[model samples]
Target chain A: MRTAIIGAGQAGRRTAELLRGLDAEREILLLGEETEPPYDRPPLSKEVLLGEERPRGLMQRAAEVYEAQRIALRLGEKVTRIDLGAARLETAAGECIAYDSLVIATGARARGLRIPGADDPRVLTLRSIADARALRARLRTGLRLVVAGAGLIGLEVAAAAIQLGCAVTVLEMGERAMARCVPEAVSARIEAWHRAAGVVLEFGCPLTAIRPQPDAIHLVTGKGEVSADLLLVAVGAIPNMELALDAGIAVDDGILTDADGRTSHPHVFAAGEVARIWQRGAGRHVRFETWQVAQHQPVAVANALCGEQKPYAELPWHWTDQYGRNVQILGTHSAALEWLEREDGGRLIYFGVDPEERVHSAVLIDNGREATPLRRIIAAEKPIQRNRLLDPSVALRQLC
Target chain B: MAWHDVAPEGEFEMDVPKVVQVGEDRVAVFRLADGFYAISDVCTHEYALLSDGFCEEGKIECPLHQACFDIRSGKALDEPAEVDLAIYPTRIDGGVVQFQL
Candidate 1:
């Protein structure tokens, strides 16, 4: 049997490796829109943008490893359409690939900035390796970098640019940074860190339009006008669900998939950043563009494809590195949950609890050490005694 | 270098990792359930101190990016870190923990 996997990012490459390991005889075709080998995505905004590291050996496997694994990797090819009934995928080059089982790991694309100067040459988005290389060359000591969003990617870029001696300003529509992902306290601390680093952070100001000139790009916002040598639109990402939608697969923001990675179609499956998976206990759809999910989700998807049915029940956990500080978050928080915070060794740790005082999420700032055990605690949804969680003497292993 | 005294026994608690200077080398001395084990304090991933991190199940997680290193083996068991840490032999001399500098 042959397996065709679409979009060769972290999820695509990982799933290919898993499928190859599971069954050697199965034909595995890994397709990617970009020709570059799969490099770690998180580092693009951190080390790579700062020019501290080169883009070498960033792949899941070396060339030799790919050759040894005998997996067919097709790069720089876009899937134009997916015919679910025929089980055929049409590529941009007019090649119709037939697969017995298909996995749509198309992942998400960067949400674009829609304004007059949004499509200007000076404007860039750091979604690919090319983008990183381009932005790295443009970043100089005196350059003014105006980041459009205050999310992880945007903030990370700001930090990298500041390190390069560039004047960085971040404009966010929301009142706080990382509004969708992290807790308010965490956001406040990060904002403070950015501000203290000489980064001009303007919250509650949304960009109205951009006007690119020969020297600098002019930005008009809710507050006032600002100019930039180059602009980065790191607002957010929207899932690449059009291909799935064309195939009549149910897509709501992302490719909707069950716990076992099976989509609406029988022989078709979805995984990675693209899959808005129905989380079992959470009773909600979750689409996480995390290293953990991309690296681990394939095991369950591959298992189910091979007739071993095991659902993906891993708790959502993510981490970010900024300003030489590490932040780790397990699960997520909404307004419904109660929050309790503790300060350990000058580090702030916040725990999100349900109405019954059951721990639902944990945010550890500059303290990623507890993330491993804390992930289990969140997954278990165990009723956390407030005093025990706050006590430093109490070992996390014992409490969980 | 021979065994150099670093800290008093009472200051080092079980499963509590601390950083101390053994001559020139910065060492992370962990008092496990059994005895004391000393490894390099600086995380192999980032420059964060392992002493400032978390410890459990014979593993010391680097506070920087959660990269876990086995206390006894000094091997990095997780991602963002692939290098192993240097381990120094230690012994309790009198009431002080002396690590080989």
Candidate 2:
């Protein structure tokens, strides 16, 4: 059988690797729109922005490894159309590639600002290595950076810019920063930390207009006008589901798929940020823009393609490093769960427990050691006592 | 290879890993259900200390990205970590745990 995976990001690369691993004789073709090989994305906003030199060995696997595995990598090739009836894909260069199985791992693109003057070439967003390098080149001592959104990417860039001696200001439309993912208390603490680190954060103020100049970019928000040397609109990301949608595949915000990444078509599958996977726990389709999902979810899809059906049920997790502090979150955070907190040493850990005293989610600040044990504890689905959770003497592994 | 004293055996708790700086390399000494095993303290994928990771079932999981490694062989057993860690031979000398460099 032949498998063709489009958009060779983490998800696509992993799916191709796993499929090749399962069946060595299978013909796998991995197509990436970018010229570069599949490289890690988490470091693009963190270490790449903070360090002076680009880190070495950024590729997930060397070309020799791919060659040894017989995974044909077609870089800089864009799949223009997917003809489901013909079981083939049309590339921009007028090449028709036949496939027995098709996997759409197109991922996502950085959402652009919609306000007037937003189309200026100077307005930046960080999504790819090129974007990171461009943004890093502009970060100099005494430079003014105005970030539009206070989400994870925006705050990470703000932290990096502030540490790079740039006067940074973050504007968020929501009342609390990272309100969509983290709890209010966590966002408040992060906001306070950013303020202490010389970052000016403005919440509940949406950017109304932007005017680009030779020297600076003028931004007008609901609060007032601010001029900066650079402007970054880190609003969010939009899934690249156009090909799947044009092919008549079911899609909402992203390409719809089952737990095993099976789409409406029998021969077609989807994964990564472009897939709205049907999560059993959520009781609805959910699309995650997390590195964990991109790296791990493809295993299930690959297995399902090989005739072994295993559902992807891994817990959602994401972490961010800012100003030497590490913040890790596991599972979802919502007001419906009761929040509890405890401090051990300088690390603060928060647990979101349901009314039945079951740990649903957790947020750890500088508490890396407890991550796995707490994950097991939450996965065990056993009721835990609040006192034991708050007590420092009790080991988390024992509770698991 | 020369043996170097890492820590006293009394200082180690069961199923816990202790990191010690030996020469220019950091080694993580684990006291598992069987005995003691030593491996490089750093994760192969990122800049995280594997000593801060969770050790269970003869395997250690990186705290940062959850990349798992076999403690016995220092083999990377999961995603995000493709390189295997360096494993060092360990022996109990007198009342201390010693690992070879």
* Local lDDT at A75 for model 2: 92
Interface RMSD of 2: 2.4
Off by over 4 Å in 2: A52-59
Instruction: Say which docking band candidate 1 falls in.
Output: acceptable
Q: Write the per-residue lDDT of candidate 2 for residues A1-400, one digit (tens) a residue.
A: 8999998899998898889888989899999999878877888888889873556325456677788889999999999999999999999999999999999999999999889999887789999988998999989999999998999999999999999999999999989888877888899999999999999999999999998888888899999999998898999999999999999999999999999999999889997889999999889999999988788889888998898887888888999888778899999878898889888887878999998899989999988778988889989889999999999888898899
**What residue pairs are clashing in model 1?**
none
Q: Could you tell me the lDDT of residue A308 within candidate 1?
A: 85
Q: lDDT value for candidate 1?
A: 0.84
The TM-score of the first chain in every model comes to 0.96, 0.97
Q: Give the winner by TM-score.
A: 2
- Model 2 chain A worst lDDT run, 10 consecutive residues: A52-61
Give the Å shift of residue B80 in candidate 1.
4.3
Q: Tell me how large the interface RMSD of candidate 1 is.
A: 4.0
